[model samples]
Target: MTLGRSAGGVRLQDVADLAGVSMKTVSNVVHDYEHVSEAMRDKVQAAIDALGYRPNLTARRLATGKTGMIALAIPEIDQFYFAELGRHIGEEAARYGYRILVEQTLNDVEAERAVIRDRDEGLVDGVIFQPARIDTLEIARLRPGTPLVLLGEAARPVNTDHVMIDNTRAARDGVEMLLGRGRRRIAFLATVHGDITESTHLRLLGYQEALLAAGVGLDAHLVLQSEGFGFEDGVRAISSAIAAGVEFDAVLCRDDLFAMAALRGLEIAGRRVPEDVAVLGWDDTAVARYSTPALSSVSPDKQALASAAFALLEDRMQGYDGSGRHEIVAHSIIERATT
Candidate 1:
């Protein structure tokens, strides 16, 4: 005299049997499909709780060709903008009933390739590729027939889907803000020059355009290009520029972290912000809101970018055979005492 089955394994059938529902209905509930009636779903969920059942994500993926998991690839997690973006993206994916996998590439070419290849070989359902080095082999691995969304960074030829803020416009507006405050001798602190990605070129173009419109010449001396994007690099760039006796009325950093190092260097030299030289940075991170004088920078809606990324990726996974799409999120400048 025993019951029909024991609930030790917590399989789909356990919930189905206990709830007296079809396995398909159970699948729909677990997958968060829209069609399952609330009353029926409630019964299934109650049984699932009683049995402590967990959906077999692997098997479900096998049957439906979906893992309910997506990947995000980036250079590092320390940068405030990237870190903030990562957090928002995670929340957005969870909102859509998807799990996230993160891959750190350290901005190296080979490491980026390895991660993309791993994702392509069944490790993940789709990816949000943030290209560090867009080489052919790497591009080939990430060229998504599966869902793929590109994040903001350097640019590459788009035969794929992407979502990002208007980086060029953001930069241009930052420079224009500085100019509007009656600062003409403005400097552009770049992490790199002549890069294939249009991020650098476009932002620089904005700087030039703004300068020319204001009757200011684009001086090569004011362009401080760093080999890397880091605090120490910023320190070195400022120190080197000072040694070369380059003169400028203001410094605009590509990122706020670099702006910090620039500010530090200037402070040690007894120069007051906006009094001796005005300073501006991009990507309004936590540092921007709480720095010494508080930083004034533009904020690109990271959550909007994330939402766009996942939506497009999910569509692609559902066999979306559409052309590549791109989204340029709106950005607004935040004014603080530093400006």
Candidate 2:
């Protein structure tokens, strides 16, 4: 059956003929049906590649009711880490001829719920969600039908794809580095404190583990918690620690912003980085390299993260409705003057 061509363009049957398969088989292959045999799928794909068959996205959308666009919901766009992640996701999406629209949830529960339900009946193909306020139980209940790829640790074990770095191991490594440098009394800055999200909880666990491994006593007073993960929060955290007469020889910040603020606050308190108090940060953002003392940080593979996220989304878009897949990209500790 010739699934009608548009304006002298190749049709589904054209690929079917070239692959020696029926129109339905060609369609199944194009749609990435897993039930199709690998040999048959390969034949159809080879034909598609040889013919350079470009499917008309607009026409296909009219038939399938897809928008060819995806939404990336992050906690906040102002934060350098999220902003940089969005940039990477957008670049990856462009490779598949798809555009990404970024939505800022601002760690608000209501905004996060809105993002889940914003599918609008295929107005957006799917969403790459990085929720902040919503809990795992809430996420399971609010399972939208749209294809979703969850980013970061806020995602639960629902039927979705998740991509993140090894927060616990990375945090442990950073703390161990400080310990190896003969620095004790290391403080954890900008943690959610008590009743935190998985990301914060895992990092804190790793910090405690590191100290315990090094035979260092866990000091509750040395752990400075922050209400939020912002630069000002970092400043307040450091300043408060100083005023409270906390004696810390090193600091492990939650993110680059906190590390940057800690650097400034330490200076204001008549202290020097790596001399008085060595500092370490997560998410080796762009500014990490240019900080006065060139901050040390844990650098997650952003390119690998983007590629994995896009690949998972594409699989979902093509109707791969398997179990929840969690992909872990690699992360490395970037040593610098700060350590």
Leading candidate by lDDT: 2
Clashes of each: 0, 0
Q: In model 1, state the lDDT of residue 319.
A: 82
Summarize candidate 2's per-residue lDDT along 84-131 as a digit string, tens digits: 888999999888868888888877889998888757667689888998
lDDT per residue, candidate 1, 110-206, as tens digits? 8876765556577678888787676544564456545677786564445677777777778778888998888888888775633445566667777
- For model 2, the stretches where C-alpha displacement exceeds 4 angstroms are 1-60, 192-196
lDDT of all predictions: 0.77, 0.84
True-structure lDDT of candidate 1: 0.77
> Pairs clashing in candidate 1?
none
Residue 60, candidate 1: how far off, in angstroms? 1.5
lDDT at 303, model 2: 85
lDDT of 2: 0.84
